[model samples]
Target: MKTPNPARRSERSRRAILSAAFDLVAEAGYAKLTVEAIAARAGVGKQTIYRWWPSKGAVFVDAVLSLSEDDTGGLSLPDTGDLRADLSGVLRAIVDEYNDPRLDAMSRALTAESLADPTLNSEITARILGPLLEVTKDRLRSAQRAGQVAADADLSVAVELLYGPIYHRWMLRTHPLTHEYADTVVEFALRALEPAH
Candidate 1:
């Protein structure tokens, strides 16, 4: 019998691990998640998991990212050439995710875990939020080219303006996160980024 190659892991197994990690968090919350459980659920050895990920947080973050990224492992936002509509659509989807019971619990748990682990926080930012922000900035750059945004506008700041309010509302739970609320945030952000008249 030939030993399986350690350098080239089966993609199916990798996906199974990610799916198991996600389902475990959704079912039992992140506090109860463990690499052993993920390995068992994935039908792989704990050593396999350890070799692939440094921590359960890393596995879980990758799981979350797997859901958002495309087959090519890239993320993007819609660009209808209408900045307002595109941004509104994106914000509304974010509100919907925050409102989901399973995703809400998972997201909150990840946030709590990140607070205590700076490394995990950085990973979340770099792996998850960073790509999302960059893609959003790309969309904003397109809007700028279309004369929908100020040419001199700082796009990084523009992306934050688009996303920050919804993030604040979700974190604080001060108001119901709804599509209408998303549209309102988009409106305010667009006003702030309006091309210099």
Candidate 2:
């Protein structure tokens, strides 16, 4: 049999480790997740994991990135030409995903990891959150160019206004993030951005 390239084997091992880490964290919570356990679950040696990821937190961040595949695809907000519909649709999807038990747990894990390690937090932001936010900002800028949004509106601030409340509610567990709630958010944001009478 032809020998598999070492790089290919290494890539496979890394993917397995990340997948195992995500499943373990999702099922057992981050507090209980460890590199040894992840290595065992992935059927790879501990040294393999250590060689690829520096720490459990690094593994967890990789896991989060792996699990975010679906949410991260498309990455850009929909520009349906109707700003209201586009923003509402995107926000609704985000709210739904935010409320998912698995995603919620993963998010909580990331937050905890961030609190414990500033480096991990920066890594996560640069790799995951930052890309997502950049895509959102691009969509908002598109809306502005199309005259769907006001010219003077700050796209970054506007995107934050649309998403900040949803994150606040999700993190605080203050209110249910239902479709109705999403609709209300879109309505309020549109009203605030509408041209002055």
Candidate 3:
């Protein structure tokens, strides 16, 4: 029998740990998630998790990322030249993902846990929210280069405009998030971002 490659075995262990973390959070919530529990579920030693991550929050963020992987390997904002359509596509996808029972449960649990714990919040911001905002910033910068966005437009504000409404609606549960709403948000945001004559 061929000897197992160390790299492949490590990768398998890592994916297993991520899967276990996602499943645990989806079932028991992040508040109850512990390194020991993740190790037990992943069938690895606690030291293995500690060797790979400094904290459970890091593992949680990694799990969240792994769970959200797509054809491109992970979720990323699109840059299709049509700013409105690209933003709409991302927001619509977010809505669809949030509608999944397991994803919804884990996402909400993470939000709550982050709110209650500053360290977890920092980890999540660095790993999850930071990358997402960067993708939006990159897309806006591309649009600006193409003369599709105003030169003076604040990219940070633009990012907020694109994602804030969807997040607000999702968090408050005040209304259903639909593809139509995503498109509407894009139209409204693009109107504000359009270059002046």
What TM-score does prediction 2 earn?
0.84
Positional deviation of residue 89's Cα in model 3 after best superposition, in angstroms: 1.1
lDDT-better candidate, 1 vs 2: 1
Return whichever of 1 and 3 wins on lDDT: 3
In order of TM-score, best first, we have 3, 1, 2
Give me the displacement of residue 185 in model 2, in angstroms: 1.0
* Cα-based lDDT at residue 55, candidate 2: 86
What does candidate 3's lDDT look like per residue over 13-131, in tens digits?
A: 99999999888887889999999999999999999999999998889888877765642215567787887778887888888877877777777888888899999999878777778
For residue 41, give model 3's deviation from the true position in Å.
1.0
TM-score of each: 0.88, 0.84, 0.93
Q: 17-74 in candidate 1: lDDT tens per residue?
A: 9999999988987878999999999999999899889999899888987885452124
Whole-model alpha-carbon lDDT for candidate 1: 0.85
What range of 10 consecutive residues in model 2 has the weakest lDDT sum? Answer: 67-76
Candidate 2 local Cα displacement, residue 136, angstroms = 1.1
Model 3 C-alpha RMSD vs. true structure (Å) is 1.9
Model 3, position 185, has a per-residue lDDT of: 90
> Which candidate has the top score in TM-score?
3
- What is the lDDT for 8 in model 1? 62
Q: Rank the candidates by lDDT, best first.
A: 3, 1, 2
lDDT at residue 86 of model 2 (Cα atoms) = 74
